[model samples]
Target: MTSTPQERLRLVGREEATPAAMSWVMSLDDSDSPRDIIDALGLAPFVSGEHPHALSAELERVKPDAALCPEDARILRTSDDESTKTVLAAGEGWMLRVLRRTNGTAMLHVSAVTEELARTVIEVCSKDATVAEEADDTQVSMGFWHSGAHGFSRRERTIGAATWPEIEQNYSGDISAALGRLMALRAEDVSGRLLLLHGPPGTGKTSALRALAREWAQWCQVDCVLDPEVLFSNPGYLMEVAIGVDTYDDSKRKWRLLVLEDCDELIRGSAKESTGQGLSRLLNLTDGMLGQGRDVLVAITTNENLSRLHPAVVRPGRCLAQLEVGRLSPAEATAWLDRELGDRPKPAVEAGGMTLAELIEARDHPTRIQAAPADTTAVGSYL
Candidate 1:
């Protein structure tokens, strides 16, 4: 007395089925096979796509009214303190999911019976999410890169700093002149692909680079590599940073400047011995075969002196500009302090001139105890 497959399927859910479920069951025809009925109930043959962008308040504007899916939310969260959130919503024949993180990043997934519906949902959610804008002239959009569990990832941040003109007085006169030339460079003026800034710490090297990024924001994309040692040691990681698609515009790519800070060990005269192929790979990325056809520039900051760096790195024609970001001269330091202190009595300038950091410290706390400078000869001891 075994019933047909259709009868078995209908009977399985009969007792517990809601009115809507029962109505759907009754709509099944005799011509429909068990597999066809199951497929129809599960919404098969749907189109799906995903888009990622910076999380913004505009997500509230997504159409079809996305709602929270409590069951699926925070499943990927490692701890209760985590800030990742997930929401989902479904309409007549479409479903959308949004996963937003605390770091201002989000991923959107949409599924629908038609391709057009999926695309429309994505467009609505991503319209204003991907735009990178600064709040003011003092801030510039910069990308920060790091290798994570998910792989290499970059997050765009609006970094705030003084303009080159505002901070030009911070560096030595010679260094300021060289940097002025470098900052004023047009795309055609790029003779070499590497930019090297070598000096002891507290000389305003990092500050200068920040200003440089703001100046070139119009034509060059600046990305600071957080883990440069890993970048050079891992070929895959280097390639990912070097040739990865520019998210800004794919049609006409902009120049990129990759900043590696405190890379003393990676580019020293004995780098080949200490870092192995790390130095070679870095050289290749700057001007060798790896650099050909790519509008990429490598800008490195280190406490190592220029003479102590690898010959290949500082050789003529390799670096677009090799500037020594040293402390200002005694006269320059005295003038800076006088200008900064104004009517207040200025602190005595060090006989050997003063680094920007020292000058700032002096201006803020003229009487604080000063420790001896860290040993710069040791790699990674000073930034």
Candidate 2:
């Protein structure tokens, strides 16, 4: 029987891929010959121009039938003004692939087929550069993961997020002020590793997050975790997202805010009792030692009640800020609606029970949404 790729270990001279070795691993090229680009990148140490090298030997043993194995490699040519082309080898299951563009921005991709090995492999590789110095060039960044891997597709300066006043123009309660203080909270403000934003949907959790991201653009980089459920379950996945591989280790430790929204399953009161991946892993990520001194800050948005959150998560010194995002009052909603939707004759639009998202939707389609009936039923009110 043929062994699977996951069973193999990608060893480098009796050791796994190290940061320095990874830099060398990525420098390997196969554009001209199998691992041909290695010469172009001047990989004098990693490979030889010889026909059969250690790398090909590794591949050959793993995939005897070349037709059946899917080759994994990429060549990125980045030319803003000056152009450059870089190539790296790839194959399914424990392969070394380098994502390098013409502009010299490089990201290393190293994954083992199994979770444990993948974790160990990535742990070694990222101890040096997953995102690397790329963080310096990215002011505002956005990323998402699929099947446990992700990339920063774009960078932004402002993202055009609204300012405090613009976001809270309809605020009739103290949430806007609370948001002010929450966003203003700095590293010195608290010892907690997490921030909790709980409320109904459409209560401006997203807007407030944006405002905070923009407000703290100087030192904070907001990263919205697209898949919170798989984050803790996949060791290799979480390592990259939680402890970015390309992170800088300067005196001024860089910070990335991992924002998980609508994570009701991960922060519920029953989380502490469970041993499974859902809430338990999240608690570990937040309260466990791995999160203790890490420069990353966790932000979770959920419609679940704050009181229902596991005590371990919301306990003293664990959360930097816990803000309840509620909808605007009737009076505030009236004024806000007037601002959002041009002033018109008064309509009995019951805004008290409505969320900000609902109000905005109504405002946008005023013709469709009729005035509130004299007697309407209570909303389940997730927002």
TM-score per candidate, chains pooled: 0.71, 0.59
Give the per-residue lDDT digits (tens) of candidate 1, residues 123-240: 7657645434426988887888899754676777778877888989988888899888888887778889999999989999899889989989888888999999999999989988
Models, CA RMSD each: 12.8, 12.9
lDDT for each of the candidates?
Answer: 0.73, 0.57
Off by over 4 Å in 2: 1-139, 149-158, 245-252, 272-277, 351-353, 366-383
What TM value does model 2 have?
0.59
What is candidate 2's lDDT per residue for 86-192, written digit by digit as tens? 23433333444443443324434344445554344444434423222233422344444444113323222224466665676644468777777776767566467
Number of the predicted model whose TM-score against the real structure is largest:
1
Error in Å for residue 316 of model 1: 1.9
Structural RMSD, model 2: 12.9
Q: List the residue pairs that clash in candidate 1.
A: none
Query: Which of the numbered candidates is closest to the native, going by highest lDDT?
Result: 1
- In terms of lDDT, model 2 sits at 0.57
